[model samples]
Target: MGSGESTTRKVSFGVDDEDRVRILRGIKLSEDVLQRMRGVANIPPESSSSRQQTILKDELAKMAEREREAAREELVKTMSRERQQARKEAEKAKELAQQLQKKDSQLKALDAFYKEQLAQLEQRVRHSHMFHRPAETCLNVKNQSRNTAPVCPGLQAQILSCYKDNKDQTLNCSDLVKEYMQCINAAKKLFCLLINSEYDLNCISIAVSM
Candidate 1:
């Protein structure tokens, strides 16, 4: 009576081919277990074997369906977790790429700024050097003037006196002017000779020290 009621309760089970196969396999496995149990225990003649077999098939099919459902739910959860993990990884990669791009842009900006500064400094230096040349030449002229020996005052005086005396007849001062020029030339030559001699003496003294 109990076996017949259980078969009636779970008779509607499989529809598709895979479900049918599972039902058939579950039935066979359950039948094997039943046969083993029957061997161990004495069979009661009142209980129908065919009715018991039908009840076992139905129960085993239901058990297989529940296990398949649980496996599908576990698979769905695993896929969902993998998808979430992949999304998080993608977001991290995108953020890292953006950071790298920002750093590269900053480096480029700094390079351009330094290059512009270097160019400006070079231009200022060029202008400074250009303006300094005339100042340096003026300084050199001042130094030369300071170092020069004075003219022959006696010769200059004679020329001036002659010119004043012959103011009404300027040609009479010509000889005196010529003599003054010769004296000035001779003095310049003597001064240059003395400077060269002194330079040579200094060189000789340095050589002796060495």
Candidate 2:
């Protein structure tokens, strides 16, 4: 190369002052590169991605509703079981109360029946005691204070026969005993004779009244 001659080569791309001459001669951008640059500038919004997000949200909501329904169903089943148990308990209590009332009524009836029987038995005993006192037997025996004789079997037999014939009276033994006592006192001397004669008659009247 001769002294003072140029040696720098000029280029278009990446051009500095050495390549500036080549760039001025002819420098054009490629169509494919220009299209890629325009695509970057006009990027579309993420509308499809937003739609997917909305679909996912709807599915989650449906799932939440299903969970709530399941939970409500379980709660209803639990409450129904509790209510049924309570109803059974209430019925049992009511039955127990009725049984107790029945028992009380039966006891009261039995008590009243027993009391009636007792009263009847007492009345019979009083009547028998009043009518069957011993008499003084006066035989000519030495050093005899008073020979107390037991009730005559024949007289008692007659009286028993009379009572048996008329044994349906409501009168108690006390009433007949009181009447017979007064009769005996009024006829003290002939008391035994009168008693033996009217044993059946008096006893029958007493039994009928009783």
Candidate 3:
């Protein structure tokens, strides 16, 4: 009976040792699973923060590009306005130059016309002086010789009358001047013939008396 009780106690001890090994293995596996779950949970927050930073950077870049485009558009508009204003000013200057040139031409034409009129008046005055001196000499010669017929008396009277009627237009007496010249020439020829005839008569009378 002693031997059998010893054998039974050994069998009980072996069964208790096998149950402790299984329990230890189960506890180790549970700890490994809990650690892996904690690692998965921590990774998500870091990844989400990185994604938010990328989105913010993209928005800032887009805003900068829009500002640059607006600045370029404004510069183009300002340049266009300046060019239009310059063109208008140039056109106005050209028009003013044309007006000044036209006025200068008109002034030159007027000056030439006035100068021509003055020259004509001076020539007329000289002609008047030439005729007046010859008329006065003829009158004196006529006063000294009352016995001889006055040379060109009627034509001289007509010339004087024409001059009186048209004081400013002395050229009106051209026909009277021509008649007076012809009368003077005829009178000179007649005077020469009369002098020759008188000399011949005197010679005849002296010879007959002798």
Q: What TM-score do all the candidates reach, one by one?
A: 0.33, 0.34, 0.35
Candidate 3 structure quality by residue, lDDT tens digits, 52-85: 9999999999999999999999999999999999
For lDDT, candidate 1 versus 3, the one ahead is 1
RMSD of 3: 21.1
lDDT tens per residue, model 2, 1-210: 678796775534333563221234445656455456446443455799899999999999999999999999999999999999999999999999999999888866755654465455445544544334423331222442433333233433444454455454322333443454444343333434444454544434443443
RMSD of 1: 28.2
Where does the lowest 10-residue lDDT sum fall in candidate 2? 133-142
| Runs in model 1 lying further than 4 Å from the true structure | 1-48, 117-210
Judge candidate 2 at residue 128 and give its lDDT: 46
RMSD of each: 28.2, 16.2, 21.1
lDDT (0 to 1) per candidate: 0.54, 0.53, 0.54
Candidate that would win on lDDT: 1
Global Cα lDDT for candidate 1: 0.54
Q: List the residue pairs that clash in candidate 1.
A: none
The full ranking of all candidates by lDDT, starting with the best, is 1, 3, 2
